[model samples]
Target: MADPDTLAPPRPRRWKRLRGGLSIQSKLLLMLLSVSLVSAVIVGAIGFTNGRQALQDSALDQLISIRELRAAEITETIDSVIRDASLQSRNLSAQTLSQTMNAAFDELQSDPLSEEQLETLETYYAEVFIPPLEESSETEYSDTAFIPDSNAGQRLQLGYTSRNLDLDEDYQELLAREDLGDGTAYSAAAAQYGDYLTHLVEEAGYEDALLLNLDGDVVYSAYKGPDLGTNVNTGPYRDTLFAQAYRDVTATNSVDAVEITDFEAWIPSLNHPTMWVVSPVGDDDGITGVMAFQLSLHRINNVMTGGEQWAEQGLGETGEVYLVGRDDLMRSNSRLLIEHPDTYAERAADGGTSPSIASRIAEIGGAVLLQPVTTRAISEAQAGRAGTMTGLDYLGGDSVIAYAPLHIEGLDWVINARIDTAEAFAPVVEFTRNVLLSLLGILLGVSLLSLVLAQAFTRPIHRLVGAVRQVAAGDLNVQVPGGARDEFGDLGNAFNDMASSLRVKQELIEEQQKENEKLLHTLMPESVANRYKKGDETISEAHENVSVVFAELLGFDDYARGLTAEQETSQLNTLMRGIDEAAAKAGVEKVRTLHGGYLASSGLVIPRVDNVRRSVEFARQAVEVLDRFNAQNGTSITLRAGIDTGTVTSGLVARTSLAYDLWGDAVNLAYRVRSVSGQPGIYVSQTVRDRTQEMVDYVEAGTVETQGQTETVWKVV
Candidate 1:
């Protein structure tokens, strides 16, 4: 007898210590996540600042380098032309031009000396010179018509020289011009000058230049002008080239050569902003005529302007750039300046002043208060220094400024680029911001996940606490639920499996009782039958798995119909019994009586006996039995039987009948023999034929297509 007070259980140790819901692990994970989030933001901000600054510096350097490259290209081209010009001045002579021209004209007129020969003349020659050579010069001077020496046709000639022909085609064509109208002397002098000019740049250090007559006509120059009347003005360059420069050049015998600057360098009167030299052609005492040539500056804007386009592409969306002239005005060709030109114009109008740097900057909605830094590239031209700096105070925002001077052909232009520092390094800043924000989100999410996990762990622990009480109360199947994939899930699954196994164990015991009853039944009739048929130990039932041979008597159907029922039955029974005894003598197992002679082999189905090879022998013995019985009874009979030896399972043909049967190939092949019979005495199947090979003879009927096999039949009589 247990005491009632002992049922009061002792309190558990764990519940007293635990709080509830979230555990300590959750709080720790949340703290780690918060710290990570804060750290990420701070580190990202610092990295963005440093990375952006570095990228901006690299970009500015690249821009400056590219501009420098373009400037170098322009300088080199100018230097080549300059060197060529100097060579012409020192080495070219009039004698060279004369000798070359005479040879060229002579070649043009040499074909059969006909006046019509002039048709093939692509060389430059005056109409007057052509007539003399074509009609008279080859005619010995006195024998020609139109008063030979006094004729106007004798005075002119083609312009050609060894050097002019050897130069680039542009120079050769310029020298080859044919018009000697009015100022023939100037024309002649200019052609001789072109010959020397051709080789000058390659030989000396001077640029290509053209010297014009005070009449704005190209006279004696290193690079000859287009032609005498082919509009010799190079459009906007005409004033700087031909107006006063021509006058000043003509005033002095020769001016030491100087540079030809860009459009901005043209200051009308005193020190003409153009960079060039006027060397006058005259006697040594004083100046009479000027021979002018253009100067090559350290930079050329034509090439530098190309750099602006390149920079715009390189900088992408970072900054705006401008190429300002010496007058502090923006070069009008730039897209930023040209399209929004009114902005600067408006500012100057409001201030009642000429367009200047500060005015233009303000007009364009930019700040004028920003400190402007310049490169000391062209102090002589009064332009400022070049470099990169921040655009301070002006826009009231962070900005970077970079600049370079464009000095070429006496024009000193500055290329200034200003970008918002934030804009210039935007790629790095954006990338950092995104990365930081993503990290912060990941951290916050992790903290939230930690809280969730803490709640989950606590829930399982509480369930475990309740389960412990249940287990103390002797409930062995008590369970706890948690979605954890860790060891907890394994424990839960194992508990479920144990409960399932316990339930199944009781069911197995009950099932064993019914199985014992069924096993008794199975071991009775069925097992006994199998043993008898298989020659096994149990001998309770009769069964035989002999080579069954079923033989049927044919023509009994027609013959029996012509007779009385008694006679018919008597004759058929007599025929079957005779075959039965013969089957018995052959040691065959006869299952029962039938309308036909049915006989099964003896060895496998009944008691074991030797000399029973093929079931065909049983079919053969049945035929002999029927033949002799028919002879004794004075009756005619035809028999067909099939034989095959195989496993046979015996069972009742029906429950309420004495007829029993054997199953499997042994019985099946016997039926086949009955189906395939033709004019049967004793017909046996191919299976019977093969099995009887040792004791009987077989004639292999070639394979015939039937019953899933190419088989043949034989009558073993």
Candidate 2:
């Protein structure tokens, strides 16, 4: 057999120990909480993932719809521009203006312009035209190349355009001027046809309208711009997109044919992005002259951006639809530039756009041919692919883009509807937040319910534990209810019986404690008695200033000699009670009673400013109390008190039987100033007399020796 001493006792199993430590309520709570938490987490996670994907698909689908709608609208606007030009070219006004302007040009060929007239044309081109063109294009343009070679074109331009150079933006002012008073056939043709063509340019939203003859000379210009009489094929602006459109239209030679040119920085319009739609104007003969309509970016921008009502169009705050040409440059005004120009400039520059380009966009108030948008969406759309994606936008921020190639006839451009991903996925973010909060709420509710059910199952045990704890904490009043017929009920019955017995014993112990406290309080102050009960061996306090009153009842012993011992004791007790009552009213503390003296003090336990006055008034009230006592007892007695003010030390003395006492200069002086065998009256030391002299009348009393000094005393009568 194995040695029993060497064998260890069977160790407790870990699970068994754990089960022993956890109560039934705790086990039930943890199990229920675990199941609830896991379920909430799994359900919330699945819901969040599916909801997020749905929101993403919805946002992308919305963008695609906006992109398709804007692209169609933009295409329609471009097509209308071509159709308008075709209609205008077929108009009789344009055909008659072309023939009449050409005839006038031939007539003015015989009337040569004077040298002064030629000099004025050259000066206008030099000072008013070339300077701004050079500043904007960053290239020099020669005045001689732009000045018309023909006398008719020169005289007409000088009369209608150069004379009204200051009215560039004021189209009404230019239209109001009918004749320049110059006697020429060109002046007559202009005054007759100016208003109709000006109406076409103003009402049709074209920047300008021009009629170019077969010789490539611009014979008529509405709004009287610098291009009024310049030859498109030979002027300084001949290489521009405007001139290309004119040349293309003339080359087509068919009446139904029209040519639309892409945007270019035309020097004639101060280098602003300019495009033109040119069509042939004809009679019975072949194509006569070209009618070119300068297209404005306003119509296209309004279509693309929905007239700046992005929100009403189902596009949120950051959503916008824009166009990009095949060359990767914007073909519409930027919504950001129109609304917040400085922010557009800063964002453009930060996105790798040159400062010069950004500043130009801000200054021109448009980004038709300036702002570049090179992105994956643009590239895919340019390659003829239509799709939705998330990628970096021009401002280097994540954007949800819907891109497609626009199917306009003459332009290779792409339209992109984009919104910041932060704005697009905002719903998904809110859904995620709500899901997490709901998960937490579910867990919180499950936890609370589990706790409540667990507590319900173990409530009897919990009640017993609470009652036992209260009894352990010395509250013997706690009793357990024994209503149920279970083991807990039996335990409750036993516990209530024990609590009843304990409470009875506790009452006896409390009564003994009260008796002890009463005896200690009579020997010392309540504060000192409490400290003694708390096991304090020594209790002492030093008061900085206090008034001590040593009062004695003179002739009390002689009055008591006539009474029996019991009468004397009873009468003395009544007299002491009166003195105690007077002391309480005066706010004075009676320290102890001597054989025939009452020792009291002020500012000992609690300091007071009027302690000297309070002590003196207490002595006077004691005399009155004695007078009442003498009348009741048929005996004569008097009260004499000594009062003084100064520093004093008061504390408990004696270890076996504690006694609170006061002994200091003020105490010694107060004791010595009171006469043991003399007239009965209140006396005070010199310090007390000085402090109370203003409040009380005093007679000079004999001196007393205290602290090795002779202090003068005063008697209060």
lDDT of 1 at 421: 72
Q: Please give the clash total of every predicted structure, in order.
A: 43, 0
CA shift of 664, model 2, Å: 99
Q: Encode model 1's per-residue lDDT on 465-560: one tens digit a residue.
A: 676677567565666554333444445555656655655776688799678657534333444444444544423333344566666776667667
Question: What is the TM-score of candidate 2?
Answer: 0.58
lDDT scores in order: 0.48, 0.82
Error of 2 at 7 (Å): 19
- Tens-place lDDT digits, model 2, residues 1-717: 999856854423322333334444564466567667788889889988999999999999999999888887877888988998898888888888888888877787677778898888888878877787787777877676577777767867787777765535566776666567776677778789867777887788998888889989888787666787788788767888778777777887877888888778765578788778889998546777888888886777788889899989878888899989999999887778878987888888888788889988887788888889999999999999999999899877889999999897777889989999999999999999999999899888888777766654434477689999999998998986553344554567778989999898889998998998788878887887778778888788788889999988888799878889998788788889988999899999989987799999998877899999999999989988988877886777887788988888878888686767888988878888888337788999888888888998989879877767788989987
Off by over 4 Å in 2: 1-20, 23-36, 167-169, 283-285, 444-717
| Span of 10 residues, lowest total lDDT, candidate 2 | 11-20
TM values, all candidates: 0.34, 0.58
